[model samples]
Target: MLDQTDHDDNEPSAPIDMLEAYYAAHNWEFERHDDEIVASIKGSWTTYELRALWRDDDSVLQFLAFPDIKATDDRRPALYEAIGLVNEQLWIGHFELWSSSGILLYRHAALVDGEEEPMLSLSGAELLVESAIEECERFYPVFQFVLWGGKSPREALAAALVETHGEA
Candidate 1:
């Protein structure tokens, strides 16, 4: 129940309230990062991720987010969810979903120096893994269903990826 019903584009009060409610239910703390809202959760052994939000030029909503991850040696892009504000318009973003673990790998879009073109770069694997481990500790059931044999589905798939790329 996100409140995107306000007629005034300048006033983003409703959406803010919806986000607050959503996070509160999940036991996350929400904070303001410039013009965006960041939601964070705390854990014992691992650190939680910071989910972020903002508005596009058309008043469409955008989420700069991450999936729960485990610490790995690979340097790869993470998955992110870019849900559309309304039904018609598509909110564009890229992410790699781990079918086994049901974890998402997100790459946040960043402003490159002296470049007009927007860039989506891979976040640090350490951070991503820490976030994922925290999430797994908090929500074990979902992760259990998503992953197989205590590993994300992507791990199983990675073997094939090497063969596909002729690395084998």
Candidate 2:
């Protein structure tokens, strides 16, 4: 059994180790190198690149999910508006467009601090990752519609947010 209280000098490896355990438990194939866990999870609309980095200095685990695509310059304005509207409805995390890459992604950070010992747990990791996946699955089409469908932000969002009852 791995010791949960083994936070030595705020080493970054501890969080990654915990995440390794979490991935194993969920049967997820992931690559661990340095302070990051890299995995690709397939969603309803696309495949997401899950990049989780352990920030040793800040004691934060930043989890990012990229949707395997990037925004073009012409679509930037509409994409930005859609992101704002989507972000307003998100309760846990928000979406961001990396300036240099123009890649869209979901961002969430979890503070790894334990009162008695390290608070890092598999359940916590699962919660954060699952939440990102859920949000990504729900809103992915809004990006696609605006970026590729030649639709306005409002139109794209409305089409994506429409509720369908029961299985078709």
Please give me the total number of clashing residue pairs in predicted model 1.
Answer: 13
Instruction: Evaluate residue 27 in candidate 2 and report its C-alpha lDDT on the 0 to 100 scale.
Output: 64
Off by over 4 Å in 1: 1-13, 42-47, 68-104, 107-155, 158-168
The local distance difference test score of each candidate is 0.38, 0.81
TM-score of each: 0.34, 0.87
Instruction: Give candidate 2 regions above 4 Å deviation.
Output: 1-13
In TM-score terms, which candidate is top?
2
Tens-place lDDT per residue, model 2, 1-168, is 223333333333366787776666556688999889998767788878888898877889899988876999888888899999999989998998988889999999988976644456655666788899899998999999999898899998999999999998
Let me know the TM-score candidate 1 reaches against the reference structure: 0.34
Q: Give the worst 10-residue stretch by lDDT in candidate 2.
A: 1-10
The residue-by-residue lDDT of candidate 1 on 16-91, one tens digit each, is: 3444444554556778655466666655534455554434333333444443554222312221111111111213
